[model samples]
Target: NSKPKDTQQSMCTPVCLGASGMVHVLLREELLLKEHILKTIILGQMLSLFICGTAVTSQYLAEQYQVNTPMFQSFINYSLLLLVYTTMLAFRTGSDSLWQILKQRWWKYIFLGLADVEANYMIVKAYQYTTLTSVQLLDCFGIPVLMALSWFILRARYRLIHFLAVAVCLLGVGTMVGADILAGRQDSEGSDVVIGDVLVLLGASLYAISNVSEEYIVKNLSRVEFLGMVGLFGTIISGLQLAIVEHREIMRIQWNWKIALLFTAFALCMFGLYSFMPVVIKVTSATSVNLGILTADLYSLFFGLFLFFYKFSGLYILSFVIIMVGFILYCSTPTRTAEPTALPQPGSTGLDNAALKLEENDSETPAITVQFTRGEAVVVSTD
Candidate 1:
């Protein structure tokens, strides 16, 4: 009787232990999956914030430069500062490198050159006419326009929540733009700032187009290679403007060491920023990319508030809150698919194999076999 009882107990032990092990493995896996999802989301948020900061800072610097272009030009001490930067970059990089990239990505360089030159010139011109706040407020239109373009042209499927969020942002834009218009009219000088606003709008549209175009460029080139090309092209475009618009002024300009230093700092800031923006987009999602731009707007507004004592009225402040809340509502909605996940074709192993390997016990038991026989037997067991 003791022998029979002992045998029964021994038989139950392995069964009970196996079941417990399976349960433990499943729990661990669930925890890991949850952790991974949380990490991805957090990273997305951080990337968005970082991108925004860079963008805001760049705009602020541009505003500063606009205030004193000739002075800014003098410090750089070139009749054509844009050309100077381009020439410097070209010389620094050497012809061989530039030619190699031109051969591979000529069209992309053209787009970058066009966008950069237009964006820079417009922003500078806008700042000379309208307030920084006005330029930024008008620039808000870019985000919505880009989103619409991405949806319609790029066929980027967005959640309904995203559209609602954008709608909220548009309302904010209307309020701010409306405020700027009223404020402009009340100004004693009464110069036509409308041109400045329109220029900014055009710049905004170009930016949207460039940002989308970059997605393709990144696939073909290294980050360094792409940015170098953009900077080079931007330099050329600016050089032409310097030649055409301010050549005589530039020739008569006297160098100011202090201003030159400031210009250098500003250029460095832009270089760092533009380089990082695309990289951030690559690491994160497009929504995050847009979020970065929005954040930058807030940052720029805050900087304006600090530097210029730019005050926001009750309506503008209210609009800001509503837009942000709408964005939060949209961004917080669960993504059905985060980044695109590649699926294996028929006859190839699927992600299930990878997912299974992530199991803790399976990791420890490297000899475990995943058996999938033709049309019938599918088993995962220790070999």
Candidate 2:
């Protein structure tokens, strides 16, 4: 028993203790961030604004251009998205050789592409069957749904206060949607709000899934590879779909300069927004990222009111406030657990240590001796 304790202590020192020390600091920083009411409020506002604005722009493009093909729209959206992310990666992953960048983990791109592609397609299809406001109502559900998934499936932990905050924010958002629907502001004639909601729900679900998947992927992949692959794959899928579905319409339509400018602007906005989102997530917590984006609703609201002249009932205001509150609550309540770092086992050479040594030496060195607690030792050399 005494010997076992000694061995345990020896193994625990650098591995467990060191790990705990580093993690404790990180956890503290995360907690400190949580305590700051100002940070959460500011971040939430920013995120919401961006989200709203982007939605408005998207809806405007769809309506003005009368683009009917869901797949084609998704393709175009992603093509632009790919370009944006690529440029971001170039700056973020500076000095990484192109070959090396390609070699980096790429599952992230796949996940992003899949989520985005599905979201885009679902949105376009939903719009065909419903109104922009209706589609938005359904789409906004993604935030809460995302929280639930993150909590249960991802096993992310949160405090009670955080949950309460999320509830408030979600309630506000719900109010807004309810208000819109009750005011006879649903999508155009022949478009089913029910179907649109369902489609949007599906799209939201996919988006939520992608968020979780992105966390894991980001841990392994470089930004370049992640976004590059997404752009490349999404472009291919969208292009094929466009070729089959929109070829005739595209050829017949007049290429107005205004339309071209709008499309370019839309593409640029999308690429830039998405490209920056991950960086924001990395710099802060997902909660901050989500809540900060709550302004998206407000942006949409203003767009609907002014740019599109979309009418809303008093109920719309109530619903919007409720949903916004709910979102705030949702974001305020932490759902994701900080990822724990893997530590080397007793008697095992640390991967980090080995890599550092190799980088420094770059030589065929003699065998490095590794000893066990029982006084037994073994030597393994490296090339």
Candidate 3:
């Protein structure tokens, strides 16, 4: 009887231990998921606020001071980025040092910077041609474009919840548009609505490209690297463009303390947006960031009521609430990487296998795996 009891106890020990381990993993995952959701919401809202600040400042400059130098405004922001991030990058020495990264991937950052600079210019230029409400609403066109890029480039797989959430967010946008029409806030004084709308659409598309590239860089590499490269290249490109296009406008401006202050405010807001965007993008995604920032329009509307003396509408409040709901719904589900493995190229080492083992062993933390193939480092997975 004693021998039989001992045999039964031994048999149950492994099963009990395995069951307990599985439960612990599930509980940890649940906790991590909740933390991720909270961080995403907070960071996303912060970015939305920063962008709203930029929009308000830019609109005020265009309206009050006739400061229509989009290139110059963007150039200021890029210069600040160069002064901050690129300077910090210069001190680091490693494979990721500024010179090393430039040697390996200079062209990539150039395109990224160009896309970002143009996107900013187009959106700012739209302010001179369109209503504040229109810029806010039309800017959301980037969400779908961003999602498509993420699908193809990042291989990000989303669930049905994400699509549903997007629909809800768009529905909220429609509500806002209706409110704008009801309030007669769709048109601005001395503005070309058609041209503004077109510029916004183009800007949004470019923004999608920049944002997708940002996600890839911040997730696979580092935020500092992305900002540093963007700063370096953006400063160069925007400086050249500003000289060519906005020199006359710059000359015509009646310099004043107020105008100078507004420009400084705009630069600071834009710099904050650039600096903090990578944090949200790393935790959530480009698509989600775009979705979350849809509320920036609502923020703009709130300020517009006081600054532009626009009439208030209950629909705007409802629109804000709806967008928040959609953002929350989208974030409730986690987006996972799809088929993360990449094929080995010529002269491949065992690093890819080691990375796979690391990913498996470290399931709790988000891991970025780099596969070396043909003298290049390809990002195989990020989670």
Q: lDDT per prediction?
A: 0.57, 0.62, 0.88
Return the number of clashes found in candidate 2.
48
Ranking by lDDT: 3, 2, 1
lDDT at residue 49 of model 2 (Cα atoms):
58
User: What are the runs in model 1 whose C-alpha is more than 4 Å off?
Assistant: 1-67, 70-100, 127-134, 152-155, 172-190, 251-254, 312-323, 333-383
lDDT, candidate 3, at 14: 99
Q: How close is candidate 2 to the true structure, as a TM-score?
A: 0.67
Which whole-number lDDT from 0 to 100 does residue 27 have in model 1?
100
Evaluated with TM-score, which candidate comes out highest?
A: 3
Error of 2 at 272 (Å): 2.2
Give the distance in Å from residue 147's predicted Cα in candidate 1 to where it truly belongs.
2.4
How far off is residue 18 in model 3, in Å?
A: 6.8
lDDT: the better of candidates 1 and 2: 2
**Candidate 3: how many backbone clashes?**
0
Per-residue accuracy of model 3 over 244-344 as CA lDDT, tens digit each:
99999999999999999999998999999999999889878988899888888789889989999989999999998998899889999978888756755
Q: Cα deviation in Å at residue 29, candidate 1?
A: 11
How close is every model to the real structure, measured as TM-score?
Answer: 0.60, 0.67, 0.83
lDDT of 1 by residue, 1-383 (tens): 99999999999999999999999999998777666445544554454455444444444444554334532332232223334334444555554355666776688678776875676567656766666566767777677777766666445667888778777766765665565455452233215677778888997887777766665456444555556666666656666666677766545545577545555655554544555556765654455466434534544455656665666556657656666666555555544433343632325544333212223434555554454333233546764
The lDDT, on a scale of 0 to 1, for candidate 3 is 0.88
